[model samples]
Target: MAGVHVVANQKGGVGKTTVTVNLAAVVADTLGGTADSSPVLGVSTDPQASMLEWAERAGNELPFDFEQCHDNPKLLGKLREIKQYSHIFVDTPGSLENESILQAVLTQADDVIVPLEPEPLSFNPATRSIERVIQPAGVPWRVLLNNWDPRDGTADLEQTREYIAAKRWPAFNTVIRHYKLHTRAPADGVTVVQYAKNRVALEARQDFFRLALEVLGTGGDGPRHASAVNGVSSTNGG
Candidate 1:
């Protein structure tokens, strides 16, 4: 069985699909996946199927296996039965109308990653999803600050951190900073690892690499997986 990590939030435009693909890609790279064997799998439960489309656009260049399981409860429920992949990252729908799909995925999730923007308006919807769906599922979850721009100063970032801390929510220390590269990735059919080798591209890829380490329990404070990779046993809890 693979560790199922669902990237979910009830609000739109929080970079759920972006985080799902990139995180899976970097983790697969760290695991040294080859052309014939991909250790990571990316699944999309959004009716929009953004992740699936991104994989299609990427052609055969994606580092991990990809699947679209939207409206398919049977597939979502059977995720744990698949043993080939070490990790499975799921991109879920952000709309309330498709919440049942989110619920179905959560039932099999070993961990959940909630992406939240640094804005007051996003707080309520993020909290609603955490409290309503995630909490009930009893899965370990952490909030990730996405689309943060250092140029805009740290006021918004600081305030968002304060909000999460006030609510006693677990969060990642890593912030997925805003970058035009990430915005253009879907249309360009590229992941951070596939970006042109430049300063900005290196920075973009590094962020996800650090995030992947945290998810694998090799770095930072985040949930650990039961599996071993590269002789490292990620067995500790966050």
Candidate 2:
């Protein structure tokens, strides 16, 4: 069976869909997937169907398979049964009211990637989702620092890391910096790998490539001692 990775967070606007699609794309590319036979699959359980829309906009250019299974717990739970794909990346609903949808996908998650913006307000809800939903599921999960701007210096980034450490939460060493290319991706129907070959685009794709290596267990040291808190070992990546 394929490894099922669900990108989830209870709070909205954390780049869950962006993480799902791009991570899947980079992993698929790394694995040498083709349009005809993709090793990766991207599934969206969000009512907004953002992933599906993005895929449609990209037309036949996406490197992996894509699907939207909104409000369908049975389909979501059965994803692990699919054997063709090496990995299945799921984009889930963002609101607490969609707890049922989130719960359904978590049932199949081998690992969960929770994208967190480095801001004070995003802290509580992220912790809430981890404590109430992800931790209870007992899956090895990590908090990914997304949308961080290095131009703003490392204070906010360092503070976010401190918060995660104080709570003993697992996290990726890979911080996905803020890039206008990422914001323009969905509208342009492109993934990081499909971005124009410019320095900025290269940097954008490199982040996800490093992240994909980590997710595939081929990069970086594993996450901090998060096993002590959740009793599940966390994996690290570059």
Candidate whose TM-score is highest: 2
Q: State the lDDT of candidate 1 residue by residue for 28-100, as single tens digits.
A: 8888996578999999999988888899999889989988889678999999889999899999998999989
TM-score of each: 0.93, 0.94
Query: How high is the lDDT of residue 139 in model 2?
Result: 75
| lDDT on C-alpha atoms for all candidate structures | 0.85, 0.88
Which digits, one per residue and each the tens of the lDDT, describe model 2 over residues 63-135?
9998889966788979989998889999999999899898888888888889999999999999899989988
lDDT value, residue 115 of candidate 1: 96
Runs in model 1 with CA error above 4 Å? Answer: 224-238
Query: RMSD to the native, candidate 1?
Result: 4.8
